[model samples]
Target: MQTPPDRRSFLKTTTAAAAGAALTSTIARSANAAGSDEIRFVLVGCGGRGTGAAAQIFNTKGNVKLVAVADAFAANAERALKSLSRGENESKVDVPPEQVFAGLDAYKAAIDVDADLVIIATPPGYKPQQFEYAVNKGRHIFMEKPVATDAAGVRRVLASVEESKKKELMVAIGLQRRHEPTYMETIARIHDGAIGDVISQQVYWNGGGIWYRNRTADQTEMAFQTNNWYHFNWVCGDQICEQHIHNLDVGCWVKGMYPVECNGMGGREQRMGGDASKSQIFDHTFCEYTFPDGTKMFSQGRHLAGGWNHVGEHVQGTKGTANPGGWIKGEKDWEFSGKKVNGHQQEQHDLIEALMRGEIYNEGEYGAHSTFTAILGREACYSGKVVKWDELLETGTELAPGIDDFTIDSEVPVSARPDENGLYPVPVPGKHNPFA
Candidate 1:
């Protein structure tokens, strides 16, 4: 993707000093209170996204360094280090071999280093626990989203958000759309009634399935499960929570709150045969979420190949309709012709800026809410029942059971139990109850 001219201008012209010129008195004071001229950061997950985030942080307009890295597997950390040390971000790598740790408990050792910021980019199952630990250590954070696989994890993240505020730690969540200039401008107009009252909304992330890791002979059950976490409900939270959450989040942002209730249905249409023990997740989910104002959001996600793929949001209002990421039609017709910076990079830009300005920036609550929103839709689909926000959060169902104390030989939360010939248990509308 080419960088938009406007985005280039913003990145080129908006230096910390330039941005500070228009800061409020409070923000200016906060900026002056910034603790250090050099900021050291650590990464908890050394996957592709983590490496990309580190590159973005290095691109930020201030003194920054990638000091340490941790991962569930040593191979991933080694890959990230090699990649980071060879490219344009090579100068930013200061992590000694001793600073790079591996294993399930590696994050704690990395977080204990003298660092100002920590990037929690691990799988969703470990996000809440890792994020909570980062907050407790008083380190600023840039965490990936859907922050958790279930509501129990969402509560922990929400609590961490409050604690972050009290500690004045800058926390940025990877809902990259919210950081995009076009999304910000368009959503602001919608909120200002540019498209009148939003009557209905549609969001989607219908596309092909993600990569599947083949289990090796030496890999233990827990190792294989952790390596292939995407196929397990205890880790990835199904397709809805893992990938479709981005679109669902846009719906919630447009509504200014999470949905009140959701009734949905989903199933595994394409996944079949072979090693049935490898997966326990659905490939498709359809949900109808009702916001507090009675507005309805229809959402659908599928992973089947050779199907129509649509990955965007459409909002229909009384006066007109709008594609919040693009343009509006009807009475308030407008288009976002702005220069585009990469949403991924822009999120890091905003976070670094907030930290530099000493202004309080916390996306924990919003991230958790959007994550819960995804979970609500999944729960509805999973159990084939209407799921309410309040009740869902109180279910206290923890995915990845005993994850906090798991060794390579530990039993997985959900066994790959097959019936008869070979077929893992799948959600069957009225037959399966995820919450129960």
Candidate 2:
């Protein structure tokens, strides 16, 4: 069995190699060369989001080309390529049939292709390994958030961030809200004291539901779970880390700090037709996160249908209150009336523009930290205990142990098979040990 590479050992080896060679100058020259020519990129996970991201890259103002693409299933890769080759995106996409890869190890082959950027939109559990590989290859990255499915994964990304900085790689995490004009203006005001002395905050991702894929007779357990990754803890990190991360990230952005400690409660209800066996995740979670200054942020995320739903962030300070989406209701009320742009598209533009100008920006560190914040909240909810940030990060269980060795036929930690009572082992609040 092969586990993830140890961060310390990897860093030690890479650092020693870097010192012996002109790696820094060589990478700088490569980035400069890319700026002058068409920036070639590869897509590692060709799902809907990955395909959309590749489209956005084509839409970016640049001489850019898609060189390769990969996915866990060959169908998805073919479909994404077909979709991208239609109409306007056709000329921009140049991936041949030979460049299309499938299976668990497909990401490595895609990354090994001749490309300047790697777009990683795989399941969160695989992100750490993929990111480390990209950084080692000295490729700029744009990976979707949340970055990881567990604390161990978070630590892995954090370690990779350092190496990326040393390589001057431009990394972008898909927390697109940070790139939106409305959010950028509104958060700037909050930071500038429009909402004076931030004291408390609230964020949400309460929604109706998400899609579920039924197991097919031909599919193995690993393939089934990978296809329907959201319901499993080891891959998706539940709804909190997946869907709710946007709001939680906004909360942290507004406060300008990550939570020091958090205690949360969550349980599965009204999910998978009310059958616990179908999902290993909670449909609803409420978390109270405390900052170092004693200020608190309250978080609510639910997937239950027919409930009052909200999907935004709010900050309450000494002088006033604000909605980070676009407005402030403080001493002097204000609303944004600026030119609005699609954040999803804008983020790609920023990355491309920055690379062309030779300005390297690495969003990986903050992105990893915010991701860990969500993981902390999830663990707190699972264990029904106050989970401190440092403790959980340093010594939490690896959700997908020996993840690098996983194949379509390999066994997942959480079994898809049901017990005699036809129930899966959903986490019990008092008994679930996230650290074990």
Candidate 3:
């Protein structure tokens, strides 16, 4: 019955209360004489990725503290917290057993605590609702990449973005590539026409790794797993929306707008284990998305790990092109190669600086826009037809429910819905909001 934080209030604070001298050194909060401006945190997920973010915060200035922690499993959360405390995070974490909230509503318990920052590090399936609450509370957020798994989850995030802008809140999404200086500088060149008139481009995410599947018998259906979120179409919305979203986000960064349309094709020819619990996501997918002005971008995401195809992006232009992941081309043969840049740190550092500076930063918009671009690729792959962005988004078919309340079959698409074979939901294109 509680209305979430006002997005406008969230947006307004970014420029107001946050920009003082305390924010000057964004990487680490400089300890003050009084040590007063404490940025307490509540980590919602304890997976490797979530732990990585927690560690980053530790390496950063000790201005913020990990006060409380939560997860689906108490052991996992405590493990992560203990690891942090034993290592560099000992001085920062003050969470007692009682403060360590767990279970489905763990996210809520963490956010409701007295804290300055909220790290929404859970699965993509649970992002919208927690993010919504964090915004309402006017908390600074360090959210992971790929904001949502489907269009419906996205619509709510889009709304949240607008509210964040109005409130001046500093919202950092997980897409760390955008914060990297090399990538930012390179993109500026492309926009400056260094590559001449831009044309279509190609990008890839390929390699070898373990296959995604259902959890073992010991885990409940609600128990979380990395591979499970990867396979469940409703949860991960196919590889295109989940992993490949980074490339799609880059495509949006290059095009400077949400894609106009996408046509894609995919097949689950591999990874045919019977343990695929209600999961029918693709093993591989290739999509072509066009911008409003007719600029084209091609994306190829392959799951056949350890293959000859390495990962990168190629931007074609009359003057030549630049490939992300450190490849490049030129018209008169002008060329420059880059060493691998650490993007995660770049984005994290930027967020720290933004928070300290109290700059008006919000990932809600850019993240939502880029995520929807990724979903366009998924919708196209599922429907077997070319889909227009304006139309697909118009249906208001949210993948994750706007709210977190779920009662057995509570009509929430954020996670999954069983198919005839007892598999989770697949994208039903014709339906108004199949995921929800």
lDDT of 3 by residue, 1-436 (tens): 0111232432232222222321232323222213466667778888778888887877665476788888867777888888878855688888888888777678888888887777888777678777888888777788886778766677778788677656656678887777664566566577667777767878777655444454576665545333366666555666776678787777666655556788887766554543345455766778888776687899888776445565666788788778654434564433335554566665666666555444535666666777777788877776667877777776635554543664222453534655556665444444423223
Write the residue-wise lDDT of candidate 1 on 13-78 in tens digits: 222211222122233223221365777889999987898998888889967888899998999998
Minimal lDDT window, size 10, model 2: 15-24
- Estimate the overall C-alpha local distance difference test score of candidate 2: 0.84
Q: Which sections of candidate 2 miss by over 4 Å? A: 1-29, 32-36, 414-422
For this target, which candidate reaches the highest TM-score against the unseen true structure? Answer: 2
Per-candidate clash tally: 0, 0, 33
Where is the poorest 10-residue window by lDDT in model 1?
A: 1-10
Model 1, global lDDT? 0.79
The order by descending lDDT is 2, 1, 3
Q: Which of 1 and 2 is ahead in TM-score?
A: 2
Off by over 4 Å in 1: 1-36, 272-275, 415-423
| Order of candidate numbers by TM-score, starting with the best | 2, 1, 3
Better of 1 and 2 by lDDT: 2
Q: If scored against the real structure, what TM-score would every candidate get?
A: 0.90, 0.92, 0.84
**Best model number under lDDT:** 2
